[model samples]
Target chain A: TQTVSQSDAHVTVFEGDSVELRCNYSYGGSIYLSWYIQHHGHGLQFLLKYYSGNPVVQGVNGFEAEFSKSDSSFHLRKASVHWSDSAVYFCAVSARAGNYKYVFGAGTRLKVIA
Target chain B: AQTIHQWPVAEIKAVGSPLSLGCTIKGKSSPNLYWYWQATGGTLQQLFYSITVGQVESVVQLNLSASRPKDDQFILSTEKLLLSHSGFYLCAWTRTGEGTLYFGAGTRLSVL
Candidate 1:
């Protein structure tokens, strides 16, 4: 079974400040990792995904995430956050080979204060 | 451009009432459909998925069932609504080989 873990339940940052939301996964085989954002009262939107090649994948609205094989981690980062960036972020994982059942972490709620 | 739509944007119902939610995808053929539910302040949990017409697969058991009656339609239904059934229900779709999923606006269900 694949499992995803988002270590932080919430993170607060001021506008223009850098932020990193931690995520870690445990899987024995090839896996797909991705990040999604859900704004207040809205459904989830895909941010970015990593299956192969580049470890660092860029996403919409100036967000990026790096996948680490050794650490089994896929942490999302933003150089600078805007007030509009405040939302709930989720990290998901699935096995690349078979039974692509997506599993999500509890999510990390971001608060960007101006 | 493909579009996904969900019906009954918000619903309030008493316990033991029957509930049915619908989803439709347009401008796409043979798309993979999915149903996901999320509790307040919680992560999304995928309930069902369908790869083709009349072939719905349950990912998790929530005392609910899903059906794909047409190429573009998916329905979620339960004989009795429990308080635990109250949550946001979202419909999503992707191409046969695509990994990215597109989601609908979602239906907010409140079971009293």
Candidate 2:
């Protein structure tokens, strides 16, 4: 079974400040990792994904994440955040052995204050 | 370009009511389709997936069932709705072997 954990339930930061949302996973075999953002009352939008190449993957809206095999982690980062960046971020993992079903982490709610 | 659309933008019903939600993908043929449910403030859970017409796989048993009637159409239905069934339901699709998923606006269901 694959499980994803997001240690932070909520994170608050000021506009123009950099922020990183943490995500960790436990899987035995090869897996795919991705990040998504959901605004209030909206469906999730894909941010980025990591599979085999490049430890670091860049996504839309100036977002990027680094995959660490040693840490079992894929953490999302932004150089600077805007007030519009306030949203719920989700980390999801899909095992190649488990088909297309993805196991998602309890999301981290980000609040950017202007 | 491809687009996904879910019908009945929002629904409110009483428990024990029959429910049906529909999704259609345009400009994309033979794409993999999926149904996902999310409770308020919770992560999205995969409920069902269909790779082809008349071939649907259940990922989680939530007392709901899904069917693919056409290559581009997917339907989710339940004979009886439960209070716990109230949540946001999303329809998504991607190419086979591609992990990127594109989602629709989603249907918000509220069971009283």
Candidate 3:
């Protein structure tokens, strides 16, 4: 079984400040890692995903994530955050096998203050 | 382009009452469907997944069941609802062997 962990439950930062949300995973084989953002009372929107080829993958809204094999981590980063960037961020993992199950983390609630 | 639609944007049902939620995918054929339940302000828990018509697999036993009666439709239901069953229900679909998922607007259920 694959598991994802987001150590921080909540993160607060001033608008235009750089931020990084940590995500770590534990799985035996090839896996897919992705990040999603959920605004209050809304469904999650895909941010970015990492499977192969590149260690750093860019996502929408100037968001990006870097995958680290030795660290077993896939952390999301943004150069500067806007007030609109505040939302709950989730880290998900899925094995490359045919099974279509994705394991999601507890999520990190980001609060961007202007 | 593929679009996923979920019925009953919001529901308020009493405990022990039977409940049903529906999802339909348009413009996508043979997509994998999944049902996820999430408590307010909490993480998501995958309940069921279906890869084809008339085939559904349960990931966690939350006293809920799902069915794909048609290629484009997926249904989530339970004989009896519990207070704990009240949460956000999300229906998502992905292309075969693809990892990214497209989620519907979701149904917010409140079981009193």
Candidate 4:
């Protein structure tokens, strides 16, 4: 079965510092990777997605992710964190394009301290 | 722009009581609709999906049934509420070429 793993249960970073949220997947087919952000008491918001062409995909709010086929991973990175960036980040994987039925990770909650 | 709407932003019900949750989709024709349940501090678990009007598919939902009564409406119903069923229920929709899911505000279900 397809599965996604997010090792970090929680992470803390100070404003103006760089941060990385890791995600790994174990799937046999071509995978479509995505990242979502959820604030407390609200629905999830799509951050970014990556498929065939580019290994690096940019998302809203200055977020970006890199897909490494060799590592079977997609990790999110930000050069400078802002206090508003504090939220729970979830990594998801889909088997095919437009299928959207995804296997999500447990999520990594980031606390950005100002 | 496409949008999804879910009713009863929050619901509080007693055990053995009937329950229903509604969702409506807009700006897309023959869109794929989905219902998902998320436990507190847990990831989302898909419950049901509807690919077309009047057709619905179940994923791992327990003691719940889903129906697509119209082209843009999906309904989730249960005969009796369970305390374990309390959590966040989300409604989502997507198109064949859209990899992203447009979600509703979500309904917080609290069963006693």
Candidate 5:
């Protein structure tokens, strides 16, 4: 079974400040990791995904995430956030093969204040 | 461009009432469909997934059932609504050999 964990339930940051949303996962075999952002009252939007090769993947809106095998982590980061970035971020994981059932984290609510 | 649409943007129902939510995909065929539920301020939970017509698999049982009568349509229904069933319902789809899921706008259901 694959599981994802996002330790922080909420994080507040000032506009133009860099932010990092932490995510960690536990799975036995090859896995696919991805991030999604959901604004209030809206469905989630896919940000980025990592399967192989690049440890760091860039996403839309200047967001990026780095995958670390040793830490079993895939943390999303943005050098400078805008107030519009205020939303909930989710980290998801799935097995590379088999059922490919996607498992999502609890999510971290990010508040980018001006 | 592919589009996924969910019906009845929002719904309010009483307990013991039957409920049905619908989702349709356009510009795509034979796509894998999934239903997800999220409580207020809670994480998303996968309810069911269908890779083909008439073959729905349940991931978590919440007294809810799903069906895919047509290749492009997925339906989520329950015989009776429960307070626990009140939440946001989202439908998503992905092509074979693809990892990304495209989601619908979702339906907000309130059970009294």
Candidate 6:
């Protein structure tokens, strides 16, 4: 069974401030990690994904995430958040091989106040 | 590049009424399709998935059913919807040999 855990339910930051959202997963064997952002009343947009090679992956709109095997974690970060960046972020994981089913975290709602 | 589309951005249905939601995937063939439901401020739960035409796997049975009458198209339906069915429904698809899923705009359903 695959499961994802996102400890933080919410996070608040001021405009132009940096922020990081934490995510952890429980899965055996190799895995693929991904992050997605959902704006108000909009579809989810893929932010980034990590399969192998470099753990650090960059995504759209100045967002990036790092995959840490040692800690079983994949956390998303933004250099400077804009008010428009206020949205819900989700972390998901898939098996490295044939298992394509994705397990998603509960999500982290980020509020960027201007 | 692949794109997904869902219809009826919002809906208000009465109890015991039939409901139908549609989704289509473009720029990809024989992709894996999935339907998910998310209650307000709740975790996303996968309802069904299909890897090929005429074959769908249900992850959780929620008094609803799904169908893929054609490749690149998935439909979700409920004959008698209950108030518990009110929530956001999202449709997603992914190409073969890929793990990332592309999602639709999602339909917000309100069962009265």
Interface RMSD of each: 1.3, 1.4, 0.7, 1.5, 1.0, 1.2
- Candidate 6 residue spans exceeding 4 A from truth: none
Screening candidate 1 with a backbone cut-off below 3 angstroms (N, C-alpha, C), the clashing residue pairs are: none
lDDT of 1 by residue, B1-112 (tens): 9999999899999999999999999999998899999999999999999988999999996999999999999999999999999999999997765577788999999999
Candidate 2 retains true contacts at a fraction of: 0.66
User: Weakest 10 consecutive residues, lDDT, candidate 2 chain B?
Assistant: B94-103
List, residue by residue over A15-114, the lDDT tens digit for candidate 6.
9999999999988788889999988777788899998899999999999999998899999999999999999999998887866578889999999999
Which 10 successive residues of model 1 chain A have the least lDDT summed?
A93-102
Worst 10 residues of 6 chain B by lDDT: B93-102
Comparison by TM-score, 1 against 4, better one: 1
Q: Candidate 5, A19: how far from true, in Å? A: 0.4
Q: B10-90, model 3: which lDDT tens digit per residue?
A: 999999999999999999889899999999999999999999999999999699999999999999999999999999999
Model 1 residue runs over 4 Å out of place are: none
The global Cα lDDT (0 to 1) of model 5 is 0.94
Clashing pairs in 5: none
Candidate 5 segments whose C-alpha is farther than 4 A from its true place? none
Q: TM-scores, in order shown? A: 0.97, 0.98, 0.99, 0.96, 0.99, 0.96
lDDT of 4 by residue, A14-96 (tens): 99999999999998787778999989888888899998898999999888999999999999999999999999999988777
User: How many clashes in candidate 1?
Assistant: 0
**For model 6, what is the alpha-carbon lDDT of residue B35?**
94
How well is each residue in A39-80 modelled by candidate 2, as lDDT tens digits?
A: 998878999999988999999999999999999999999999
Which prediction has the highest lDDT against the true structure?
Answer: 3
| Local distance difference test, each candidate | 0.93, 0.94, 0.95, 0.89, 0.94, 0.91
